[model samples]
Target: MPLHPFLSKTKLYKFLKTICKPFHVVFKYTEFVAFIDENRNKGKINDYYNKSTAYKNRFQLHDKLLEELKNKPIFYYEFGVAGGDMIKKWSLTNKVETSRFVGFDSFEGLPESWENKKEGHFDQKGNFPDINDSRVSFVKGWFQDSVYKALLDSEFNEQCVYHLDADLFSSTLFVLFQIFPKLKTNDILIFDEFSSRDHEFEAFEIFKKCTNNKWQFEFIGAVNNYRQVAFMLK
Candidate 1:
């Protein structure tokens, strides 16, 4: 299906593309610089400049927030919960006594091909992590079906921390639109593929434009050489 008519021709679309162009250049330049720096030093690049650093920074930020909100109820959501590794870690490490952790995935994987990849490329054949934590639950289906059902059932109401790992334009956009209205200031959003121009990045661009700038987010950290990024809603 085609996008809404308003989505195709808008100033926001142009503006977002304009802003994003520089980042593409910067990423390429940084890669070149890192290669040279590593060769000059006669050593492998340090963890400080890699995905490990991003994960460390992202988790540290989440930890700080968890500490601050320890006494309050928090709804933590993990999209694209493949293998459930991160969500399981979060459930175990979270200090918030009233926090609820929810993981969403098709369990059958990519609804469609992404960036020259074939459809169902990440399929897990319904094999998801068996998280034993009582605070965690899993939604099994595509975002279009499961997410909309959750919304209609009023399963989401409180402020949330979102971990978006869905790596396709359609999947990300579908999830974003479903949850955008519920997002609020202070909520944290973590994107595992933020720099992918044709996927998460494009979804976010459309989302920002469609929302008419009603909300803003501040960058917190990035990992995997900026393949992942965390932001705080403001």
Candidate 2:
């Protein structure tokens, strides 16, 4: 998935805000916009603000969780890993080969109903780049309709960080139901688009019902104006 221009701008602005917050807010705002354009021109940014920020937050939480679960290994599984950017970065930076990074995507575009994804959503066509690392792999097809079949056809091990970023409500709901029974204590589930009013929120409500109030989630942080990531401890 190529980066959306609007999303990139938003991410650059956010990073700037965090670093420049304490030093004269009004002046910092002006500087932030200028820095964003400079960075854009230098081509130092990737297109996925939502996923990148979510990955960063998960790692932060993971560090805390790691201290709590010291002996246990770390692993991450994500639904809808567009362009495989987060997986690549985390694998390289963290250097955790034992901690598997699994990504699932249709590798095509969003389902027809997802056409209304307002804040820079699109149908990504074709497969992700060849990831040489054995720790990461991409599962192709819609998780909502094909989850069972996919699992039966393949395999996914236990994961510490489970990211749900699929744009469609039904697809996200399917993942919740499919993965719910497998969740264990201290497992973290991150919902990248939870701030969206429609699909993501609706899916969360359904997840609450399906979970029978057993699983509880809370917002960890906001990615930007268009997206926020939520964390569920299981």
Candidate 3:
């Protein structure tokens, strides 16, 4: 009879080796040490942020920005308004009486596959968060279709804060290029998935190289193992 895949001689031998005397002991100890080290690192990060002016969460960061821009006529743009949760929060927490909140999303998920995620991964089909605030509005289409048109109609000639959460290289790049000319020193830019090497990170690198713009890393927030980075145009 043909050998079963799971019970093949090589597999059995490896299994036996794993469970053997010193090897098993060593493996368990190594795993335990790794677990402890990971927890220690996470704890350090949390403790440091807890004691610093640097925000420990995205909401806190937004709150700080709102405070700083209070009573000013600021323009805030949020890309990838998934479920509209953050936008709604911004609308409610906003202290700037004349500020505008613009959110852009395809409402149909990603335009293309990113890494292991296939295209249409986050499609919401135009469903957005319900906000009664008149200052809040949305551009419901892909970045390429909606950004320029929205900008043309908007009364946003002043510096603005850009929250990029699209999580795709193409979408992020398109938006960055479209808005590059309007960005000025001291303007803030937030990258929701900045750690994703092939997506947001790559897009930002390309934008920096192409524009020769200088940016200062200002803050970082970590939650549930996901990280967000903020930068200031300089």
TM-score of every model versus the real structure: 0.70, 0.62, 0.69
Clashing pairs in 3: 109-123
- For candidate 3, lDDT tens digit of each residue in 112-189? 898788898888867876888888988888789889988878765656889998999899999999887677777878
Please give the TM-score that candidate 3 achieves against the real structure: 0.69
TM-score of 2: 0.62
How many clashes show up in model 2? Answer: 3
Model 3 lDDT vs. the true structure? 0.71
CA error at residue 129 for candidate 3, angstroms:
2.3
Query: Where does model 3 exceed 4 Å of error?
Result: 1-56, 214-226
Q: Who wins the lDDT comparison?
A: 1
lDDT per model vs. reference:
0.73, 0.61, 0.71
Which ten-residue region of model 3 has the weakest summed lDDT? 43-52
Pick by TM-score: which candidate is best? 1
Worst 10 residues of 2 by lDDT: 39-48
